[model samples]
Target: MSVRELIVLGSASAVPTKTRNHNGYLLRWDGHGLLFDPGEGTQRQMTHAGVTASDLTWLCVTHFHGDHCLGVPGIVQRIARDGVAHRVDAAYPESGTVYWRRLRHAAAFHDTEVIREQPVSGEATRLDTGDAPFTLTARRLDHYVEAYGYRLEEPDGVTMLPAELAARGVRGPLVRRLQEDGAVTAPDGRTVTLEECSVRRPGQKVAFVMDTGLCPAVYELADGADLLIIESTFLDEDEPLALERKHLTAGQAAAAAAAGGVRHLVLTHLSERYGDADEERFLRQAAARFSGEITLVHDLDRVPVPRRRAVVRPRPAE
Candidate 1:
């Protein structure tokens, strides 16, 4: 079976607490694995989470903050050490190119050429990964420093209806031909169209928003996403501080998820001040605004993307 889930390697915000590590999240979507915001200690965290450098196909950095990008050197060196042959594309705000370069080669030990740098710029940009399973887009966010949010959207497809195919006596190779050509002549000489035997299936979407305050781009990135991994660095009581530091409160993150029609909201990047005891308060604050599913993540937690919404087509007039 195809696996789709978010593995939380580390979930601390600015500092590492006794329980939480710095920000690090790995999104596993079928054949693709995207590592986001690898903060300090992410290399060891990956081992705890049972993920290897080979599992990473893409590396995404929301910003160049020490708590967000400090793990880049270790992860990059590990990739080279492990001899990961597959191309690993890394994307971040173009404004942070200097920081990225410094971190990527901080202490190179036998470097590998498999890592590709694909820095993003502008208000909203579509990344070119060339024939990827989903379309990857980046949008600017409201933060003290330059930051970007990422969205992965799969293309819509048709789900074949076995009943419809059986009714038309279309079996085996004929079904494949109909799907490929949109229409095929059955053995009975009747032409059957793909539309007559399939239902529209909306593709799933996953959004990653980190280190950003309330902004229009946040909503755009989270729009209609099946899963949204966003930072909730503060509770409602600390809204002023959150705004000052360009971070989201739990309520704000949940409100954005609700506005964007996100199905599952995985909240992480919590401030170190809020210990394990304050976790429930975060959930309460978020639940008050967003009725959808919400999760207050911890290190090594796995969050599965919600199942696709069912598409109900209205029958034609009788």
Candidate 2:
């Protein structure tokens, strides 16, 4: 089935290196393709990663930093060039509308005119797509610029148990009716209720936090998320630089993930000075702070969302 994974197109922080391009990530959530922070060369990076313009459904910019949003013009133009008929929603800080306009038309081809401007205003607010089952929201983060983090949370659903239905003599289309109507009469003339055959299943949740220092919203966005993609711009040795630049060290990011109860942490936006081989240091730093799964996001890396934990909240008391 349903595909849920993140595709890292680029993972460099502040500057691009020979190997790392810039900050760019794509979260493939079923029918949704949320592209985050299309920095320079993101178009080429996407091509290398086997991601296409047609794959994008939303473009989210964390801030106006060039390394974070420079590829906006290219992304908009390429999607239009490929004749993307569907409207793509673009979200960014509302105060940066001028910069957005500059990037939107940096170089105009035939404008598809399908890009919806869903800007994030002051404070944390929902960017209601009115389509996806999960609610999408952006919360302001602590950074040198106006940056925001994104989160998606699906509502809890009922998981029907076949054994429970069979014991109740609910079979065939009657079971479907019971699910849809929450109750139905089987051929045995007994009323079967959906609650008797189903258990509550907690919905999956994921969050993206980038280009920010230690902040309250970082934990807010990552709170109880199944997967969290966050910026780890420097190692602890560079804590001074991180604080000066309003960026997070690997340890800080991992601590935030741990505090937020994130199941999987994918660390990105690494400094180019750190080699791929040196990535293990970041991993070890995160491991020291968080017990859950940790990843050092690299170019073209794909991280699948962790499976939902089965909820037993309403189980009958022993």
The candidate maximizing TM-score is: 1
Residue pairs clashing, model 1: none
Give the number of the best model, judged by lDDT.
1
Global lDDT of each candidate: 0.93, 0.90
Off by over 4 Å in 2: 313-318
lDDT of 2 by residue, 133-230 (tens): 78889999998789999998888888888888888889898878887899998778888888888888889999999988788899899999999999
Worst 10 residues of 1 by lDDT: 307-316
> In candidate 1, what are the lDDT values of residues 1-318, reduced to their tens digit?
788999999999889999999999999988889999999999999999999999999999999989999999999999999999999999999999999989988984998999988999999888887777888999999998999999999899888889989999899999989989999998899999998888889999999999988989999999999999999999999999999999999999999999998899999999988878899999999999999999999999999988876575556798
Model 1 RMSD to the real structure? 1.1
